[model samples]
Target: MGFLQRLGSAFSAIIAFLVGVITLVSLLLGGNPGLFGDLPQAADLAALLALPAAVLLRLVALVIALGVLIGIANLLLTHAQRLMRGRALSAALLGSFALTLFWYVARAGDTSLLEAVQLPIESSLAALLCLTLVGGAARVIAKRADIWSLLFVLSLLIVLLASLPWAELEPLRAWRDWLLRVPVSAGTRALLLGIALATVVAGVRIALGQDRAYRG
Candidate 1:
């Protein structure tokens, strides 16, 4: 049994490696004939290379849709069980879900209900988030009292004040714009690059059969 399992794992790893490589190459070199130089039928070769990635992407989208449906069904089932146990929160959740679903179907895809209900909820959450950030910054400054902490608090204060409509905040608004345009943009890009690198590393591990989840 152990030997059979090892063999199955090896087969799966080989298949995964080949598929990953094909998809990566197709996506990288598929659309640009210039990458292939002046070779004969370069465009045709590029098209052929692109086909596999396109088909695989469509399959991935279909799988994602199916997964979403499965998730919704599971949520409903779990919440329904809780509702049977007299959980008011679960009952509210299920009620809201049913109402939203019914509204969507009944209105022939009208989303006015969502705009009226969801938008205010989202705005309120955003306001709460701003307050949470301010509170956290204060706590950090109180506990640490370091240069970085002070800078963080000052930056937060400036940004918050800049958001006000008062004429006294006009100068701070320029500073806020510069902070957002330069440092914030750079930090955001750095985070995105890091995430991309991490994703690539994970993909490489999976492709190389080093990921433990694929051992089965």
Candidate 2:
């Protein structure tokens, strides 16, 4: 946790430094887009500066890199608090962290993680299927009527149906896609509004120091 916190802070610093440099260059050369600076007329200024369109694309990459750095900061804050509170490590948390970190290191045509680790798309689906089977079987063997196990069984049923190449599921898949494309898009568009409302309520509650998710 200490290592992760430091790593996150260091990454944030690097991103900030790069952003500052690019912004300075963009303002200075006013067009070259040096390293990560965005200079639209860079080509027009190419003869004056002698660069290419490919160099301009670095600005977009820098923007994306900054976003990733911020995401790591968020994760560091969340996990550091969890660690300080002595929270037990859960399978979901560990698995998600591992997968995210692995994928982050496996991008840009570097599929080494996919080849050497469990980051492949096919592997993920297979793992999900195995988990569903194991969960259902364990519940049945234990003679327990767990809601979680039941939900897994129900989802597996749907997956099994979907996995089959049947005409019935064709329309179902189309409808599912449409549902996600419509309501999901609307929800995403309005997500900040919902977050603002929730933040206000939570802020009032925490004004009295009633929130302890970050408390050590």
Candidate 3:
């Protein structure tokens, strides 16, 4: 056999062995043993080891959580660096001022000052993001001219119609409700079911030594 094939078989075997060991350990530690309950006094052994096991597990979990948070912060910093570019000092100063304002508003409970300072800033940022998204979507639609682009246009129309005076546009409101309750609801359910089935398949493959995703 080729080296790669031999290596894969060896890896699969090792994974299978680990799966078997984990299954055995889980069964021992009060998992549904059912009719095989009389096999061993393993639960007592698990109870004896539980204190140290819990401490070790908590430490590992804490480290993993901290690592994830640090990774996310690093990613945000990278994006902020790209956005700020040559205005890093100005951006930092502005961010600090905004944070200070937020803290002062929180502690002072003064709505007027916050309303004067925050509303325009928030509105401008929201408008910028919305315009950026719309521009990107428009570009994609212009290039593709597909059914998705048509649907996007239709959705925007529906949103515009829905936002009109509700008393005068009652029919449009009903149309919006029907669109949300029927197609959107069905699509959401289908997506959820697909996710659940995929999760089950992945778990089964991992348990049966057919998946090597964790090896990465």
Candidate 4:
């Protein structure tokens, strides 16, 4: 676990450094493209900056996808430890089939294969999630029957109302939009600002030689 933590921290630092360098270069190019005659035009500089940005974004996405897959595999292995051999095999086969179906749909791109599998997979997942949520709500209501359960029911009702036909649910739609655009947006901005501030603080500490965890 310590090794994994160190590895994750190192990987995060590398990603941060790359992003910082790319952002600095993009700013320099955008601000003064003539400095690099190879990309003198605004469009050329933009394109040059965009290429690395896109590549970095894709790299991050690939890393996240791989991490999720690894986590799921680990979870399955852990659960398989206690299951009967036949049940374990069935679980593994079902998991692999679902993952393969998702992968194929993702890459199918305008093919009939996507059309054939996408809807069923989506519907099944949605149904499963709904059932899980309903069961959880029932348990919570039975166990506590308090404000939290009331809040959950209210939130679910709001979501259902928001999903109705726009003409019939204009008020609920407006309320949802307001909730998202105002409170949610404000909270998101605050969280991002906090992250930026923390990053700056960490950078300052490292540069001042105050952070020694990275040394050993």
- The most accurate candidate by lDDT is 1
Arrange candidates by TM-score, highest first: which order?
Answer: 1, 3, 4, 2
lDDT of 4 by residue, 92-166 (tens): 655665676677678774456545766788989998998898798788778988897887776667767898887
What is the alpha-carbon RMSD of candidate 3 to the true structure?
Answer: 7.9
lDDT of 3 by residue, 175-197 (tens): 88888899878988999999999
Misplaced by over 4 Å in model 4 are 1-119, 137-153, 166-173, 191-216
Q: How many residue pairs clash per model?
A: 0, 1, 0, 0
Report the CA-based lDDT of candidate 4 relative to the real structure: 0.71
Error of 2 at 19 (Å): 18
Q: Which regions in candidate 1 have their CA more than 4 angstroms from the true location?
A: 163-189, 212-216
Candidate 4, residue 174: how far the Cα is off, in Å: 4.0
Candidate 1 vs candidate 4, lDDT winner? 1
Q: What is the TM-score of each candidate against the true structure?
A: 0.84, 0.26, 0.51, 0.38
195: Cα error in model 3, Å: 2.4
lDDT of 1 at 115: 91
Candidate 3 off by > 4 Å: 1-60, 69-127
Q: Enumerate residue pairs that collide in model 4.
A: none
Which pairs of residues have clashing backbones in candidate 1? none
- After TM-score superposition, the amount by which residue 193's alpha carbon in candidate 4 deviates from its true location, in angstroms, is 4.5
In model 3, which range of ten residues has the least summed lDDT?
Answer: 27-36
